[model samples]
Target: MKFALAQINTTTEVADNLEKVRTYTRDAAEAGARFVVFPEATMSAFGSGLRTIAEEHMESWRSALSELAVETGITVVVGEFATTADKVINLLAVYSPSGERSDYAKIHLYDAFGFKESDTVEAGEEPVLFTVDGEDIGLALCYDIRFPKLFAELSRRGARLTVVAASWGAGPRKAEQWEILARARALDSNMFIAALGQADPEVTGVAVPKKGPTGVGHSLVSDPLGKVLNSLDGAERLEIVELDLSAADTAAETVPVLTNAKLGY
Candidate 1:
C-alpha cells in the first residue's frame, strides 16, 4: 500500500490549519498515495482553546476533511479536537474517499514530561482500525505509542499497519525516546509502525502556545521487524512511502511475540 506521512506544523487558527491540510492532501494525492496520515493537533495546535474549537468548528473540520478526501480520491487521517460537555477529546479522524468519517479518541494522555493532558482532555476507551483496499490499518494519537498493548491488540485484531500521530514535546532526549518507542512497538506487535509527528515550530517558523506538546519533529516509518524504513528530521515534510503489508506475516513468524503472549493484553 502507498501512503504519505504529512509532517506539517499548525497554529491556533482552524481556518489556517484547514488550508494546510488541503494543500498537503492534494500534494500527496498527486504523488500517487492512496492515503495520507498527519500528526496530532492538526486542527489547531495543542495550546489553543480546544474546547471552543471543538464545539464551534468540529463539524466544519469534518465537513472540509471529508470533502477533501472525496476530491482527492485519498483517505485523510488527521488529528482534531472533539468536544464533550466541558473538556475535549484528542480525536484522530479518518475521512475516506466515500465520504464516510470515523474517529478514534486518544487513549493515552500526555501526563508526563511536566505536562498534564488529563486535566484538559479525557482518555478514550477503545482502539480504532480502518481498512483500505482490504488492508487493515490502526489509528493512535501522540501519547498512545508508549503503550505496547494497544499495538498488540490492534495487530491481534488483524491490523498490519498502524499510524501513530503525534505532537511530541521537545526536551532532552525526548526525540530519542520517541524513535525508540516507535521501533519497540513495531517489534512488540510485529507490524508496521508509522510514527508521524508535528514539525518543530523552530523549523516551521511558527510560534505557538508555549505550554504543551508543541512538537519535536522526527517522523519515522518502521518495518515489521523494527527496521527504520524512512525518517525525517525537524522540518515540514510530506513524503509518499510504499509499504508491503504482507511483511507483517513474515515478522510474526520470525518473532511470534503476539502468538506466545500470555497476559497483559
Candidate 2:
C-alpha cells in the first residue's frame, strides 16, 4: 500500500487548516496514495487552549474530513482534539474511504521540556487499531512515540503498520531524538512506522510561550528493517512511500525478535 505523510503548517484558523487538508488530500489521492496521515493538531492550533476550540468545532471538523475522504477516495488519519465531560483529549481521527470514522485519543501526554500538556488534556486508556487493505494499522499520538511498550502491544495485536501524528516541540536535539525513536520502534516491533510532524512558523504563534519555535517537521516513513524509506526536511510538504504488507512478516522471520521478546518482571 502507498501512504502519504503530510507535513503542514497548521494555524489557529480552522477553516484555513481544513482547506489545506482538502488540498493535500487531493494531491495525495492524485498521486495514488491510499492513505494520508497528517500531523497532530492539524484541525486546530496546538497549545492554544484546544479544549475550547474542540468543543466549538468538533462536528464541523469531522464532517469536513469525512466528506474529503469520501470525495477523494482515500483514507485519512489526521490529528484533532475532542472535549470530554471532564477535559479535552488529543485525538487521531481516521476517516476511511467508505466514510466510516474512528479515532484514537492520545495515551501519553507531553509533560517534559517545560511543557505541561496534562494541565488541559486528559490521557486515553486504550490503543486503537484498524484494518486497511488487509493490513492492521495502529494509531498513536506524538508523545506516545517515546514509549516502546505501546508499539509492542500493537505489534502483538497483529499491526503491520503504526501511524503516529505529532506536534513535536523543537529544541536542543529534539529532531535527532524523533528520528532515533521512530527507527527504534519500527525495529523493535518489526512494523512499518510513519511518524508525521507539524511544521514550524505556523505553530510559532501558538499560545505557548516558548524560547524558540515549537515544531521541527521532519516527517518520515520507516520500513520494518528500521530503514528510512522516505523523509522530509524542515518544510511543509507531502511524501509518499509504498509499503509491502508482507515485509513485516519477512522481517519477523529473519529477525525473530518479536517471537524472542520476553518481559522482565
Candidate 3:
C-alpha cells in the first residue's frame, strides 16, 4: 500500500486547520497515496495553552474526518482532541475509505515537559488495532512511542504496521531519539513503522506560537528491517512512500522476535 505522511502546522482556528488538512490530503492523493497519516492534533494547535484551543465536540471533529475520507478516498489516520461527556481524550481517529470511523486515545502523556497533559486528557487503557487494505494497522500517538509495552501488545495481536501521529518538540537530540526509538519499536515488533510529526509551531503549543514558522520536522517511514525508506527534512511538507505488508511479514517471520517477546508490560 502507498502511504503519505502529512506534516502540517496547525493553528488556533479549527476550521482553518481542517482546510489545510484537506488540501494536504488532496496533495497526497495526487501523489498516488492510498492512505495518509497526519500529525497529532492535526485539527488543533498543540502546547501549554491548548486547553483554550481544544475542541469540545467530538461530533464536529468526526464530521470533518469523515468528509475528508469521503472526498479523498484515502484512508487517513488523523490526530484530534477527543472530547467525551465525562472527560477529554487525546486521540487518533482512523477514517477508512468507506467512511467508517474508529479511534485510540493517547496512553502516555508528557508531563515532564512542563506540561500537564493528563489533567485535560484521559489516557487510553488498551492497545488498539484496525485493519486497512487487508493489513492490521496499529495506532498510537506521540509520547506513546516511548512505551515499548504498547508496541509489544500490538505486535502480539498481529499488527503488521504501527502508524504514529505526533507533535515532537524541538532539540536535535530529541529528534534523533525519536528516529532511534521508532526504528527500535519496529525492529523489536518486527512490523513496518510510519512516524509522522507536525511542523514546529504546531507542536510548540498556543502559549508558544500559532503558525508562520518552520518546525523541526523529520517525518520518517521505516521498514521492518529498521531501514528508513523515506525521510522529510525540517519543513512543512508531505512525504509519500509505497509499502508491501507481505514483505514486512516475511521479515517478522524470519526474525521471530514477536514469538519470543518476553511480554514485559
Question: Candidate 2, residues 2-48: lDDT per residue as tens digits?
Answer: 87888887777788889999999999999999889998888876755
CA lDDT scores, all candidates in order: 0.92, 0.85, 0.78
Predictions: Cα RMSD each: 0.9, 2.4, 3.2
User: Clashes per prediction?
Assistant: 0, 0, 3
Stretches of model 3 off by over 4 angstroms after superposition: 48-57, 84-87, 201-215, 263-265
Runs in model 2 lying further than 4 Å from the true structure:
202-213
Which is the better candidate, 2 or 3, if ranked by lDDT?
A: 2
User: lDDT: which candidate is best?
Assistant: 1
TM-score of 3: 0.89
Tens-digit per-residue lDDT, 1-265, candidate 1: 9999999998889999999999999999999999999889999998756788778898888899999999999999999988777789889999999999999999989888777999989889999999888888999888899999999999999999999999999999999999999999999999999999999988888887887888999999999888999999998999789988889999999889998998666
TM-score of 1: 0.98
Tell me the lDDT of candidate 3: 0.78
